[model samples]
Target: MIIKTLVHIPLYNKATTIVRTLNSVFDQNYKDFDILIINDGSTDESLELVKNINHHRIIIHSQENKGVSATRNNAILFARENNYKRIAFLDGDDFWCSNHLSTLCALFDKFPEAHIAATNYQLKRSRKTIDTVLSNFESTEDQLLKSFFHHNYLNSIFTCSTLMIKPEIVDKTGLFNESLTHFEDIDWFVRIGMKSKIAFSFRVTAVIDEIADNRSDQVEMKYRKLPDFTDYEAEAKNHLGLEKYIDLNRFAIALAYRMENDIRNTTLYQQKINLKNLSLKQQQLLKMSSLQLKSLKRTQKVLGNLGLHLRAGD
Candidate 1:
């Protein structure tokens, strides 16, 4: 039987949520898909749980702890060899809605020219759930690239879990950058946007759990490497003009430093850049002294205890 779509899931130590993630896939309305779960040396019960499932279409591959990028690349290679027509990604800890696959298939059928398609998603934060959709400014692929460069502080676009694309697009754009410990999805999306038209749907189709103690948070704490934006700077400038690229670079540098906990450098970069587009709290934080910033963090914790959460992204 011809596989219509190859669902690639990269599993780390996500035993707690792996079964729920798989259940979401198994419940999808679209049935012409095969599931590939790449176990990236998960020391937990993740692999055992995956094997306990009785689904014949599910295939689990085990390997030493290669990061997410390498695991995804392995799935891509498997899809290419097996002649899968389309590719979709779902991290083992996240899940999709019942109609997610059916909606994407319909979108591809509607827009034959679109090589990439993404659906909106819901973000499960600490206190409450928030729905996120692509901005109205991102109507076309070029516009999406522009919006992303200018205002992708939190990666508002559909993340890897909500994205589906044709295999030929992967052939043209290549695979995710293994060197990037973070922002690998953003880098891949930029490349894909440059090569083909990206289709967007406002329909919410996935749930992304963004709790504080996730694997990504742990990785960021242990391995602090700045994401390189130099590669896409020229392309961004060419597509969205020079000023926008400058703004994008400023934000990227500040974000990279912020991720590395270099508050001094983060504040310096934020100061040198424009602040009109940033949220009021973000601006205040950037201008605050180190001691003041620490006080604000304490205040944030207090607010959280009072059931009032303040997101930096606003």
Candidate 2:
């Protein structure tokens, strides 16, 4: 049974949703794909569930807990080793729509020159759901890089589950930066966008389950240090280390302070940077942000301080 595409699901204690995630793949309308479950040091019943599944097409790799970047990198290598031409990613907690794989295969057939194709996602949280997709724009590398500087439109546009990429291109650009916790995908996408055009579909092909275990929220509460998220700040300081970017990070900290309505802390943070040095554009944006910060008031601060008791990233 030759595999045209390998769908990798990186799991880490996703006991609650692992079954649903795997089921989605098994239920796909497209059948040329194989499933590989990378157990990233999970201490839950996730492995037991995988063991119970009698599907020969499913492959499992159980190893000591490595971060998502390392696990994903291993997944890519696994796919390549199996002679797969295309690779796709689906988080253990997220599931793809039935047509998701079929659509991607068709798109690949039509656009052989495209190295990547990403679809929209349905963001689900509590009883609320929001559908997000990419807007019309030139998919050129330069255009995508310039767009990142303005805003992160790709967050909603391309999620882990909706992405399908050529194995060769991924090998050339290198794998996920295991050093990064947050923005790892963004960094990878930026590199990919630079190397080849990213074709996008407005169709909602995946459901991003935003449940109670968001990792980002845990980091914000000081419960744990998510190394990947820290890598961005570290790299900024180590590589570019531009004062402006540092200032931006500080400004973000200040915004966090403002969000908490800790005026004293906010002022202390503000003192670290020379307000006079801010570029006119940044200055204007900060000013507007400051006003919005005020509107959030003290109540929101209490809620944030209470903590996001659930999932970090959806």
Candidate 3:
């Protein structure tokens, strides 16, 4: 029998959460799907736990520590070879609600022209659940490229785990860029949006566990060491025809650099963007701040004390 959908999970050292993720997949209301768990060199007991699941529908592939992008690309290749019509992703540390797959499948059925389908999701941070909508728009709608660009910049509407796409679309759009250690999903979404329309559902049907040791946190630390926006800038102009928003992109990048205390690049990008909203004095203050490493640490400490936190885009 031909599988209707394939759920691709890229696993690492997620021994704590892998079982929950698999159980969520098995509990899905949509049953016409198979799972591909790509174990990316997890030193933990993640693989052993997965083997004990005793599910025929699950296929496990183990490879030496390739990054998330490469692991996902491997799953894409597997989906193609298996003749699956649709493909979805669920990370080892993340899980879907029972109706998540069914919701996306129904959206595809309703809007055959849409190559991509996404739903709302919740972020679980330190025992708090925050429900997030893709955009401020209505609950269900078919979004065009222009609308998507306007509503989002770097981060996508939904997280990677909440997205479903047709195999043909993947063929046309190509695989995820293995070079990008972060924001690969953003780059992939931008490419997909440029090629086809997207169907979105406002129902929160997935949960992202934003733990301290997650890849996003590590990526933020890496950004502090070295920040670069060349790839994003090229994608905005070359793929999405978002030349006008280049300055906006620069502004966002500048903010990221500022948060990282990389004031040199931040000031460079700020000057290049030259946003009019900031008064001259405010701009001067930003440019002239000492930006000492100790001061940045103190600022972070203050924010933590005040219960303020930062979340990555998407």
Candidate 4:
């Protein structure tokens, strides 16, 4: 009666979307699985709604507000203790396509060497209504690690919702870094790609609802994880593509810091990036004050209104 898979869900104040997520899990074509829902101090009706479901296959764990990383680690720890062969992560606010587990599971069966697998996931932006592939995972680990190091806007692929990994891999690679409030998954993704074999599909099996909203100038940046790539820099010395990817990583970090109006840290990351990797305009934008950048964004929006769109990277 050993479950082959454990769907790890970290719940917060997601009463509205929790049911949708669980229903997707229930609708999966793959049935040899159990669910571990770790409610991370949700002050909403989320826990009660899940309690009412009364499904036998679901195991519930509730605790005070620990961030997503801690909750995810809890689920992995649970999976290890319960002897599950596979673990899939699904956030409270996200849901999966029915074939998600089946697709990932089949990858493991087909590629015995692959310790990690994921299906393509799409962004359902209510306003634009387009299916976008988040990550185009490469065939080789080197290619994957390179692609992973790049920002999501440019050929970004993996997501927690779409990913499935063998619990055994955690032993060699390690769990999510609890200290990182953001980019923890990417940090782990890099490590996984470096340490284990990863397999991915082009087929979409998860859906993330990105409610279209205005680009906030004053984006919050509390506890953002600054990924340390010092160790990888030596690896990049041999591969120029990897060198560009390292700069790209710095670019992404600088952008996040810029978004929070922290120019000092933004400059720190920007200083590490190769100026050639960025466009002339992007380079100039990086030097601008946050207020000036916000004004430029307003201008971009106005141009969009006139049917002239400008890419953020450009």
lDDT of 1 by residue, 130-192 (tens): 765333353533222334333334335667888888877777888888776665665676676
What's the distance in Å from true for residue 262, model 4?
1.7
User: Can you give the TM-score per candidate against the true fold?
Assistant: 0.82, 0.72, 0.80, 0.83
> Model 3 lDDT vs. the true structure?
0.69
Which of the predicted structures, 1 or 4, would earn the higher lDDT when compared with the native?
4
Residue 287 lDDT in model 2? Answer: 49
Off by over 4 Å in 2: 133-155, 212-217, 221-314
Model 4 residue-pair collision total: 4
Selected candidate, larger lDDT, 1 vs 3: 3
Q: Higher TM-score: candidate 1 or 2? A: 1
Clashes of each: 0, 16, 0, 4
Q: 3 or 4: which has the higher TM-score?
A: 4
> How well does candidate 1 score on lDDT at residue 311?
24
Question: How do all the candidates rank in terms of TM-score, highest first?
Answer: 4, 1, 3, 2
lDDT sort, best first: 4, 3, 1, 2
Better of 1 and 3 by TM-score: 1
Give the true-structure RMSD of model 3.
4.6
How would you encode candidate 3's per-residue C-alpha lDDT over 1-314 as one tens digit per residue?
A: 88879999898888888999999999999999999999989888989999999799999999998778899998888888889989999887788999999999998888888888888787776678776533235435544334565544323467789989887787677888777665566557656766677887778899887763454544553453222444455555454434423444455445556667777777776776645633343344355444542365543332232222233321
Per-residue alpha-carbon lDDT of model 4 for 155-235, expressed as tens digits? 446678888989889887899888766556656766775577777677888876544221111125554455656666666
- Highest TM-score model number: 4
